[model samples]
Target chain A: MKRSLPLAIVFIGGVVFFISYFVPHYISEEILQRQIMVEWIKVISLFAFVIGLYSLIHLHVNKIKRKVDNWQYSILTLSGIGVMFIVGILLPEKFNGGIQQGSIYDWIFMNLQVPLQATMFSLLAFYITSAAFRAFKARSVEATCLLLAAVVVMLGRVPLGETIRSITQGFLDFPKWTQWILDVPNTATKRAIMLGVALGMMATSLKIILGIERSWLGGSE
Target chain B: MKKFFLNIVNLDRRWIFLMVAIVVSVPLFIPSNPPIVPARPVQELYDFIDALPEGSTIMVCFDYSPDSLAELNPMGRAICRHAFSKDINVIGMAFAWPSGSGLGQEVVSSAAKEYDKVQGKDWVYFGYKVGFAQMIIGMGKDIVKTVQADYRGESLKNMELFQEVKNYDDVSIVIVLAAGGTVQTYIYFVNTMYNRPVSAGVTAVMAADYYPYLQTGQLIGLLNGMKGAADYEKLINIKGLGTRGIPSQNWAHIMIIILIVVGNIAYLLEKKQTK
Candidate 1:
């Protein structure tokens, strides 16, 4: 009964949402979309966030209690969350109805969070160079072709790519060549992949709706 | 010679890192604006905005975070500048991520300030909304009803900018500057469902994947990464960070190319020696 009940709920909810898409009636269009679907989803999303917060705090608290390795990091995480929450609540709404501009919260987000994230992202350049140097060996015919394509595309996409074109008097234009590669071959491959993904998504949706995929309901009976 | 190649084959990566650092940093001191030839997609994007009738309202959705600020920010700023330069009204919103609301505000405010455009009549930021697809669909039906207030807690009902914009029908085009799947969401819900024209500005990595959409007319134009941003700045004839960063990018790309060539040569030499 425990398993069957949730599955039935899922089936009913899925079917209703699916039907609501096609039906143009006011009840289906307005009531279902605005009140039931959007409002409920928003409320559920908020609750889910709360649940996530609780889960995170609980995990960390347990880790600390058990004195796990790197338990000190948990303290840092909890402290960060606590401080941010306090600041957000205390700060006056300055800009739009959100956090106050130049408040401690905003300052932390802009100065600390922004730079940290950007710094992390910037590391990709170094890693890409290292990985390319290590793995991109022109050992075989296929590898050589790939290496050539990579060089051309890389040259074509940047300002230096255009410099080459100007220098060569249009006899060689990396930008034009890059555009051709991206437009034709790249687009073809991407479209095929997207088609496969779309079909897979549709099939998965159907499976969930028909209760064929109950793994979401948790462990097997 | 064989020993030299062997040493190079196992060369430490720190040297490559140092070269990249020097290549990227040297351009900042040397001001070189390499002539920008706008890619077809970027040119199309520029042309589309340039061709918009004066006083046309374009919906600019900020769907990216700071991680993508380096790329999307300049594109967003350039589009806003273009819109303001042409006297096109803007209705800004963020439904992708919460952080987008703040980023959107910064872009709009800075552009509007430069153009001496007022907030209510010239542009309005609708701020972040919770539900992604539902919020979009609702905006399609009734934007005022969906988004009750602007980012500043002001009621959007009284805002002059939104008076003409009832929904997607009233807007000229919807341009989404995104680092995530929000572009696809906008394409599906806004463009496909409401039949509204859509365009996108995405990070370089995600640019190649969206070409099919551009080809299929689902996307009117696309701007990919910092290079794309540089192209837009050139078209507008206003040099920004995008322009400044291009030299660095050019130098970095050249460095990578040199590294790859050198690495491959070393590999081939090693292989030949073994044979």
Candidate 2:
């Protein structure tokens, strides 16, 4: 009964949304999409987010209790969340408590979070350089072609490509060539991949709707 | 000669890292504007926005977070600056992440301040909300029903902006400045579903993926990374962060190219000796 109930719900919901797409009349437009789908999705997402937060906190608390390896990092994570919650939610608005602009929460986000994330992403430059220098070799024809394309694209995206064009007076146009590569071959490849992905998504969604994919129900009874 | 080639091929990555650091940093101190010719896609975006009527509204979705601030923040600011300078109403929103709301607020509010545009009159920000797909669809049907308030928790019912701009039909174009797949989401749900004109300013890494969409006319125009932002900055005649960051990018590209060439030559030499 438990399993059948959830499967019945999924089937009904999926079929309704599918039919809603075809029928753009008052029932589908007003009730199904505008009222039901939007509110239900928001409510579901809110509950899922609460579950996620609880899971994270519970996992970290367990780690701390068990004195696991790198438990110190869990403490840092919990402290950060705790501090933000306290300052942003628990305190009064006069104390700069809300998660609005000009609050202490905003300051932490802009000053601490922004720079930290940026710094972490910036390290990719160093690693990518090292990787390219060592890994990009022309052992085969395919490797050579890839290497050349990479070089051309890199040059064309930069000011150096324009410099070359000016120096050669439009005789050598790496930027134009780069644009062709992107507009042609890159697009062709991306489109093919996108089509495949879309088809796969459709199949999986159908399977879920038909109750053939019961993984979403968490576990077997 | 073989030993020298071998050493070149096997040089420690730390040395390469150091060289990269040097190349990237040294150009910033030089302070020279390398020639920037705006690409066709970027120019189209500029032209479209330029041709908008003074009171026409454009929705700029900040679909990125702080990690992409260097690339996307400039694009957001530039679009806002361009729109505000032209007396066009700008509606800022985010459907990607909660952090995107903060970024959108920063970009729109700063540019709004510069142009002395009133919040409810000239602009409104319907900040980040959960459930992106449903929210986007709901906004298409009725925006006020989907979003109840502004980012600051102020009621949107009283906002003058909402009186004129209600749904996708009211928006001239939807520009998504993204670091992730939100551009595709917008393209699918908003553009394909509602037939709204859509464009994107994406990171350099993600730019190539969208050229097909550009060809299909699904995207009206595209801003490809810092260069695209730089191009827009040039069009606006305001040398912002994008322009300032270009020389460093130029030097870095040159350095990488040189390394690729040197590495390839050394590799070939080693192959010949082995043969």
Candidate 3:
């Protein structure tokens, strides 16, 4: 019953959505599109987020209880979530209307969350340099060609690239060359890969619809 | 010579990091105006916006979060500035990420203020919706039904900016600034399903991956990363933060190139010695 019910649900739900896309009648348009997919999906997503929150707190709380490695950091995570929740709930109605213009939520988001996220992202620059220095070797013919192409692209995508071209009286316009590289060869390869990915996605979706892909159901069941 | 090559190959990664820091930071302290030449993609974006008739409304979707603000925020600001300057109405919203709405609100509000454009008239921000692809489908059918309120929790039913905008038919164009796969969702649902004109601003890393969309005319134009943002700034004659950051970007790219070249040279020398 456990397996059969989920498979039945998946097949029914997938077929309904798939059919609704093709048939544009009011039943499909209003009921399926507006009422179910838009409204019901959003409500379900909120519940999913609540479940995720509970899962996170439960996992971290257990880790602290067991005094696992780096369990202290879990306290910080819980504290951050708790403090943000408290602040969001305690704000006046005016500030709580939405996390918009003048809200304390916006303040915390801008000052704390934005900077922390940006700093984590900016660390990519340092790592990219180190990785490139260690790994980007012109060891073979293809490797040499890749290295040259990389140099051209790196130079051509910036302001200094144009300056170099003007200094050479437009004879060495890396920017123009860069545009051609991106427009021609890059587009060709990307299109090929995109076709492969699209086919793969179709196959996976069909598998799920047919109940062949039961991995998403989780566990031995 | 062999020993020197070995030493070069084995140098501490910290030294490379320090050098990169110096290269990137030096440009900031000693600022110089670096000439920005608009690439074909950036020029197309500028020309597309410039050609929009007065009073036409466009939808700008902030599909990214704070993690990509450095690359995308400038593009958002430049596009908003251009649209507002051209007297075009903007209906801003976020569909994929939650943080996107907050960031979108900040960008739209600040840009609106700079141009003396009032909210609910010149532009409206419909914060965020939970469903990404479904929201796009709903928006294509009826925006009001999909997004009921603005970022400030005000109803969008009678708003002037959205009075004529019922769906993708009323909106002239849609620009998605994204750091994730949401741009593809926009392409699939909004562009393919409704035949609406779509453009995108994405980080440099993801720019190459979207070239096919641009080539096939699925994406009308693109702003690729901070350099693209800087290009838009130049096109608008603003020389804002994007333009200012170009020198640092240039230096950083040059440093990476130098490292690659030196590293390759060291590898070759070491191979020769080993042989």
Candidate 4:
């Protein structure tokens, strides 16, 4: 009974929401029910964020109390959080008027988070490059095709290709060729992924609506 | 000595990180000149905005943070500029978070001000509605209910701009400037429900996943990452963030290429020596 309650909510809400997309008459009822369910989800999710905040606080506070190794880092992490929370609550919404100042949160987010995240994302460039160099070996025709496609995309996207295109040797338009690579092969890959995602999402939604899948609620049994 | 050097080449990942860091970062301060190729996806995106009828309602959904601003913000600026130029009524909001509303308002209003447009008279922000997907669905019914107040807690009823807009249809074009799940959620709720032709400015990681939606005509257009932003800037004849970042991207891409080539050569040579 305990497990079924959430499963029931998921099933009903999921089904009604999905169905109301087609049938216009039951739309108002569908929307009202969905809103109520969503509000409940928001309240729960906000609490979840609190739990995360609490965990963050606990981990750092515990390190300080225990005087663990490198406990200095904990102070930095804890204070950053405390400062942001305090400022977000206290700031006059108008100092940020016209522009959502984001204020200190914006400041921290731009300076600290953007660079850190960009660093992580930029690492993918070297990884992809090396992976392509090794894995893009031309052992077969298909392998050769993949190699050629990778090469074309890599070169066509750069300044060298534009410089070459300027010399009028009639090699081919890099921009046009790049478009084909993205619009054709990339599109094909995307479509295949989409088909798979569509199937998976459909099945998953069906399961939720049918009360078959409930791991999301933590142990349906 | 060659053998020892090659052995060290295969030795540690830290060396590679150091090499990559210097390759990508040092060129940031140095001046560089690299040709940027405009793309069709971005052009199509610009053209869509160009084609929108004057005073058409455009929903600018700020679903990303500054972390994604490197890639997403340029396109955001371009699109905002385009919307304001056409006198498109922007109903701004952030489905993502409290921070999102602020960031979005800044970008959207920045463009509006450039065109000498009035805030509440020409465009108004619905601000942020809390429940991500639920927020989408709520805006589908009544935007005011989900967002009774702007980010500043001003009642939506007081805003003259949103007076006629009862639901989703009131929003003619919905564009998501995001780097994360915000686009996906908008696709599911906005696209799936009202068949809203939601466009997006997304990061490169998420770009590949969107082609399927594009093929199905789920999203009318897409501007993918910095490259997409640059392309849009070119098409619009605006020189901004995307244009400025070009030289650095070029040098970075070259370094990445060289590293890949060298890394592979080392791997092959090591294999051959072992054999």
lDDT of each: 0.86, 0.91, 0.88, 0.72
DockQ-wise, the better of 1 and 3 is: 3
**Listing every candidate in turn, what is its Cα RMSD in Å to the true structure after a full C-alpha superposition?**
2.0, 1.2, 1.5, 3.7
Better of 2 and 4 by lDDT: 2
What is the TM-score of chain A, computed separately for every candidate?
0.92, 0.95, 0.93, 0.75
Q: What is the lDDT for B275 in model 3?
A: 95
What order do candidates take by TM-score, descending? 2, 3, 1, 4
Reference contacts recovered by each candidate, as fractions? 0.62, 0.83, 0.84, 0.36
Worst 10-residue lDDT window for candidate 1 chain A reads A91-100
Candidate 2: residue pairs that collide: none
- Better by TM-score, candidate 4 or 2: 2
Model 4 chain B weakest 10-residue run by lDDT: B4-13
Interface RMSD of 2: 0.9
C-alpha-based local distance difference test score of model 4: 0.72
- Cα lDDT tens digits for candidate 3, B161-250: 778888999888999999998789889988898998999999999999999999989998899999999999989988766888889999
Q: Report the CA-based lDDT of candidate 3 relative to the real structure.
A: 0.88
DockQ of each: 0.68, 0.84, 0.81, 0.39
**Model 2, C-alpha of B274: deviation from truth (Å):** 2.4
Model with the higher TM-score, candidate 1 or 2: 2
Chain B TM-score against the true chain B, each candidate: 0.97, 0.98, 0.97, 0.90
List ranges where model 4 is wrong by over 4 Å.
A26-45, A90-147, A168-170, A217-221, B1-8, B11-34, B97-99, B126-128, B268-275
Quote each prediction's TM-score.
Answer: 0.95, 0.98, 0.97, 0.85
Tens-digit lDDT track for model 2 on B144-184? 87888888888888889899888999999999999998888
C-alpha lDDT (0 to 100) for residue B136 of candidate 2? 84
